[model samples]
Target: MAKIPKVPKTVLPKPPRQAVPPPPPYVPLRARPVRPQRTNLPNQQSPPHPSAQETPIAPPGTTRSDRLKQVWDERPRVSDIKRLTPEQLSAPTHQNRMNKWRQWTLFICGMSAFGMGLYGMQIYVSLTTAPDENAVPDDLSDRFDKEADGYDEKVSMAETMLFLNSRRKALMQKVRGHVLEVAVGTGRNTPYYPTKQCATVTLLDSSAPMLEVAKRKWKETHMEYFSRVFFKHQSAVDPITPPYGAQDGYDTVVQTMGLCSTNEPVKLLHSLEAATKEEDGQILLLEHGKSHYEWLNSFLDRTAPNHALTHGCWWNKDIGKIVEESGLEVVDMKRYNFGTTWWVELKPRKGMRKQLEDAAKEEVEVAVQKSWSWWSFWR
Candidate 1:
């Protein structure tokens, strides 16, 4: 038994010693987690973590300024800049971002207030002193009389804007033969009439005082070329069929920036057609209408009330559509000033009379269904 035990002991080598894992990673006691700094605005972001290389541990700095200088110096050099991502390039720094947010918030609040004010004003105008059945309101006659004396001078202030020199020269030179000018304010079109070819002239306006100013303008110009010059104080909105119409009607109907403020622009167009002779008669217009540009149109809309009060002009009228609706054939039309200014040449179509009559009847029926008490638009 002793021999067997010795043999086993001699054969077996010591079992390989086991290797122990390195002691668990040394972890120092963690300080209380720093609560993030609160910001007044929403979406505030956390500060970026600086890499160990970027973070300069000031060696017992002598002063706070010196410590800050050392920290800034640790910032990445220019050679390392190419490693930056697009987010870093596109994003504003925290302070700049906060400032931009504040400015946008203020701007949005201001625009909201302005929009609300415009809505309130539109509602107020709709409720008070709506227009009547008569296309030309009675008060408008009195208002024109008041504006008559200084009308030319006041309108002249816009000369540079209107290109009055070139437009008037082009528009007025077209009128020839017995001419009828409807709603011819202050005879602005008189000087443009063909000096040699105009046989007779008839000036019509709703305001007697305005007619007087036109008469004065004609006299001042000394237009001896005309066989006769007649001044009529009549609303062009009325039917131009009989005694009220020009004695011999007209060979040309001239409208210069007239129908923008008219109570019934379509009606006035019908009357102009009625007053024009069936043969060789046409309408020439130099007018301002809605601008094609949205920005300019929005500006005009915002200042609608001021323009309505100052000049009897509608800044956003659709003159082109009105001409089409009137059933007049447009021989030629030129748009200038971003389509805000219209130079139109019109002639009577064969079936215009029936179209206008039907339109009048439909207008009556429309009024019966839903009343229209003021000018066409909000202004």
Candidate 2:
């Protein structure tokens, strides 16, 4: 190892002290000199000149004592700041207040929309289920059509009830010949039936309570007509074969607000057709059905099940197609009461009577053929 060289002593430079200059000599300002006033000589008074009576004037910069008195001209004393600069009160501040208002408005609107949405959801959920349908009896025929007094009076007081009853009366008057009224609740239409046009009337329903009411009403209003009116307690789809009697069959069948609650409307119409004279019989209807409007139909579909559960009625049905497919020709059809219901009158097609006869003959022939084949096989 080489011997280390001797280290030199390092000295740090010291900062110099700056001298602070002494403050300038203090001197008091001299007072302004006052001018001497001239005095009048004793006993030698100069004759009073016009200029002598004049008030003494103040020097250039001096103001008169009375004039110097703060000009307190009752300046409109403003309790607040009076002279604000334009920049201090600009439109930007006003805009900030408006923005705050807009925010508050938006918050209120959002809350209102949310509440409405929840209410609508609740209504929709209640209307589209089958629990209500299961509660009704399979047959509601006799009780609904029972003749009763005061049934109309009891129902007509409500606006909705009165409207339904009035329309029912109007529709029943159109029936003729051997007439049948289906689901004739409380026999309200019994008083309105045209006895002249209809030689006999058949009232059909399934509810026993309703039929009892109808019976009382029919006996009270038109007992003579009741003699011609027959009451039947049966399901709409029950068979009406030979034992039911062809002479007793109806030529004109009417239904109002009935199809909505039927278990199988298409089958019900077919059964009605089978119970009548195919060539001469007709079906008249005034009923609310599934709407053609997409939105309305959707709403009805969703809510109908709920209505059935709560009101013992269905709100959705396709009455037109059920009638048409029952081998009837639609003669007249119209939407009534703002498209809420349809009124239709239909008759069997000209060819339908012949077709039925042919079908019956074919059925017999097929039975004969099958019997012959069985006999041959045994032989």
Alpha-carbon local distance difference test for all models = 0.71, 0.64
- Stretches off by above 4 angstroms in model 2 are 1-162, 241-248, 350-379
Report the lDDT tens digits of candidate 2 across residue range 153-268.
Answer: 53354324226666767787777787777777777677777787977777777776676777777888877777777777766666543223346456888877777767688766
TM-score of 1: 0.55
Sum up the clashes in candidate 1.
Answer: 1
Measure candidate 1: CA RMSD. Answer: 29.0
By TM-score, how accurate is candidate 2?
0.52
Q: CA lDDT of 297 in candidate 1?
A: 80
TM-score to native of every candidate shown:
0.55, 0.52
